[model samples]
Target: MPRFMGFVRMEEGIGMPPQSLFDAMDVYIGEQAAKGVFLDGGGLYGTEDAVNFVVRGGEVSRVDGPYAEGKEVVGGWSIMQFDSLEDAVAEQEKFAQLHAEHWPEVTVVATLRQISDGPEAPGD
Candidate 1:
């Protein structure tokens, strides 16, 4: 089975959602977990609490937020294993629909990407 990452992009300056919305999300996530589709996931804090690192040449530098260029930030992410890309996409659609129906007031964009397996080992 291949793994996919589903992420949520949130527009800058959006406030926390209402408790009712959180409740709905909990139910949806629970269902996914019960179905064994959800492997791991978590939400991130706002850009205000974020730190950006840059490595150029042989030097490393760090920039502290809130970053002005960050108009959109990743709000959350989930890792799921599926038999195919189509299956992963179908699962993501369910999450998108939940947000559309329950968190209409919140600006969120959900996206999915397949996780690469990386290079093979020298000795297998």
Candidate 2:
């Protein structure tokens, strides 16, 4: 089986999602976990207190958020396993649909990418 990483990105200061969205997500995630398609996943806090190390030239520096730069940031992520790429994509689509149906007032971008365990093949 292959594992893919899914990320949900949105504006950082948009506040919390509606309760209905969380309720719907609980049911959906529970079903996925029962089927073993959902490996591990959870929502993330905003970057207000986040810390990062950056390298500039030959020096390293520490940066703190709310850095006041980007409007969009990753708000959540999940690691999921499926038998094939198609299956993983299908699952992600359903996940995105949940946001569409329940959090219609917010703009959410769900991104999916395979976790590469080795070097890519030619041209890939």
Candidate 3:
């Protein structure tokens, strides 16, 4: 089985999803959890209090968030394991559809990436 992380990205100041979407997601996530496909997941607060430590040329610098230039941010994420990529894609489609049906006014990107198993890549 392969494990993948899926997350949704939205505009920086976009508010939270509506209660109807929340209720619908609960049911969807519950079903996946019951099948042991969902591992762990949750929503994150906005970047208002976020901090980043950047390193360059052997020096570390801190950057505080509520970033004025950042146009998008991750809103929620899920870690899941599935028998195959196809299965995962199918599930992701359902997740995205829920947003399209419930929160039709806002645009969001549902991204899925397979978790790396070897080693971390060097950053530039």
Candidate 4:
């Protein structure tokens, strides 16, 4: 099975989505979990306190502000295991629809990839 990382971007100053919407999402996640499809999920805070890290001249620099140059920021994400990309897409579409209704301008991204287990040997 493959895993998907789904991100939900939220509109600026809109606050969190309604509880009912979150409840629906939670229900879907719970159902998936019951069937062993859910790996992990979580909600992120507003980007106001975010700090972006950059490496310059072999040194690290931290910059304040949301890294995205958009009206919305990723307010949350979920990682789920699925049989294929199709399954992940189907699941993500539901969230997309809900988000569209709640945050019309927000972007939704779902990237699917195979989960990799670290090599047994060091630096393998």
Query: Against the true structure, whose TM-score is highest?
Result: 2
Residue-wise C-alpha lDDT for candidate 2, range 29-88, written one tens digit per residue: 999999999999998988988998999898999999986888889999999989888888
Report the C-alpha displacement of residue 76, candidate 1, in angstroms.
0.7
Give me the overall lDDT of model 4. 0.70
lDDT of 3 by residue, 4-51 (tens): 899999897767789999999999999999999999999989999999
Q: Ten residues in a row with the worst lDDT in model 2?
A: 115-124
Relative to the true structure, candidate 2 reaches a TM of 0.92
Q: Estimate each model's TM-score.
A: 0.86, 0.92, 0.91, 0.74
What residue pairs clash in candidate 2, if any at all?
none
In model 2, state the lDDT of residue 69: 88
Tell me which residue pairs clash in candidate 4: none
Q: lDDT score of model 2?
A: 0.90
Which pairs, if any, clash in model 3? none
Q: What's model 1's TM-score?
A: 0.86
Local distance difference test, each candidate: 0.84, 0.90, 0.91, 0.70
